[model samples]
Target: MIKQPSIVIIDYGVGNTQSVANAIKFLGYKNVKISCDFNDIENADALILPGVGAFEEAIQNIKKRNLVEILNYQVLDLKKPILGICVGMQLLATYSEENGKHEGLNWIKGEVKKLNLSREFSVPHVGWNDVIIKSKDPLFTKNTDLSNFYFDHSFYFDCYDEQNVIAYCDYDIKVTAAVQKGNIFGVQFHPEKSHNNGLKMFRDFINSIS
Candidate 1:
């Protein structure tokens, strides 16, 4: 039997951990678990932060779970492979203005803000959109030519390092779709909900560590 990589999907009472777990399992990874323990976050090979909800509440949950410090050590200090999806991606940034104003994990220098469309566009951008890959990252390998992936969100990350932006999808304005700085990575879209291409993307993410 293949020695499956061990991955931890953090659950702090936020969004779908099962779906993310299911995606990793779909990738043929055998040893995947949902961890509420902060120590599990520290000990895991890779970490996935998946969230759906307001910024403040999510941050509060992270803090309340006592996972902030260990996650910082694992992600920032250890430089382990880390992936954040949707609001989980936003949490990696410096700050957010979603519900009032709040601070993020600051692992990456960026801010999360509500999507300001041209009035005609919808507030929450849902469905499929083509993502333009800006850099040659392993996660987006041959992703530009493939069909569009799934997306559903109101806020996006405003990153300081433009070079870290690996991909972008057209919304109200062209926003940061995927950001990668060293071992830390974040995606605004949900690869699990994005069909086959997304499954490939998730599989790539699972096997990204070199």
Candidate 2:
């Protein structure tokens, strides 16, 4: 049998862990491991940081598990591809002003801020919103339709380098929906819960590992 891609679904004690793993599995990436162990993550072909909840707490948990250095080593030093989803994506930036100012992984040049929008759209920006594709990349294609995925967040990434922004969504304002900087990637939307469209994204990410 052809060997499937190996993806490590990082278990930082937050977010939709199993579902993300399940989604990858559904995409034929059977060699999926959900773990906080440095060795497991370090050895994986690609990493998936699936996170939900507050920014500070998530960073605290990642630090508590001693995953910071290993993650940096693997993703930065080793140049392994990593995908951060939702709050996980926010954590990839330098800082986030969710509850208060909190330090992020600094993997990408960006900051997280609450959705500053007019009364036309709600706070969370819940449900399905169109993804305005900004760039053509292997991870997020250029031909992708705007209304392709699901979103559930109040805060979003404000990138310093506009060139890194792969796509975005509008909710009275242009919100950062996805970011791609070299080997690092982040999605403000939840692909795991986005049905078939999400599955296709999963396939793209996993297939790009080799």
Candidate 3:
């Protein structure tokens, strides 16, 4: 039998960590570990970075736990697949303008900026919105499956490469909702809170080995 991949949720102590772990468990992943240990993270089958807070605080917590170098080495050097969720996704960018300028993990070529929607919409585009799929990815087999998902953020990703944007959501203007760059992947929406749509995406992350 093929061995189950050991997925580790990088817990830097700043968000809904358990919900992601619980979601993975609900998906029937038996080897999921929520830890910050270098070995655990470095040796895992896949790494998940889940967060829900300020960009500065999130990066600070990850630094406080000494996960920067380990993540860089494992994810960049070793080329292990890494997935970032919500604020966790923003943390993967080059920098963020949330509360002053803060550097991020710099995994993807992007920057985090506050929502600048027109009068037609409001900031923190919360609620279920359409996730328009731009390209065919491992998670999305059909465009119909990329319907509505939950979102609760004021800032969105401004990807340097338009091709990197796998899926997006419309909020008066096009907003970066999901991004994929080689072994690195990020989702601006909350998959754990998105019910089945979220669960389906989570499985794509867990099983996405490259």
**Candidate 2 — which pairs collide?**
131-146
Tens-place lDDT digits, model 1, residues 109-204: 988988988988898988888888877457877465535888888899999888778888877698788889899988988888987878878877
RMSD to the hidden true structure, all candidates: 1.4, 1.3, 1.4
Q: Give candidate 2's whole-model lDDT.
A: 0.87
Residue 159's lDDT within candidate 2 is 97
Worst 10 residues of 2 by lDDT: 136-145
Candidate 3 root-mean-square deviation in Å: 1.4
| Reference-based lDDT, each prediction | 0.85, 0.87, 0.86
What does the lDDT come to for candidate 3? 0.86
Alpha-carbon lDDT of model 1: 0.85
Better of 1 and 3 by lDDT: 3
Instruction: Give the per-residue lDDT of model 3 (tens digit) for 29-50.
Output: 8898989988898789888889
Residue 114 C-alpha lDDT in model 3: 90
Ranking by TM-score: 2, 3, 1
Sort order, lDDT high to low:
2, 3, 1
Cα displacement (Å) at residue 32, model 2? 0.5
Per-residue lDDT tens digits of candidate 2, residues 73-173?
Answer: 99999899999999999999999998889999998988999888888788888898888887655666423767578999989999999988988887788
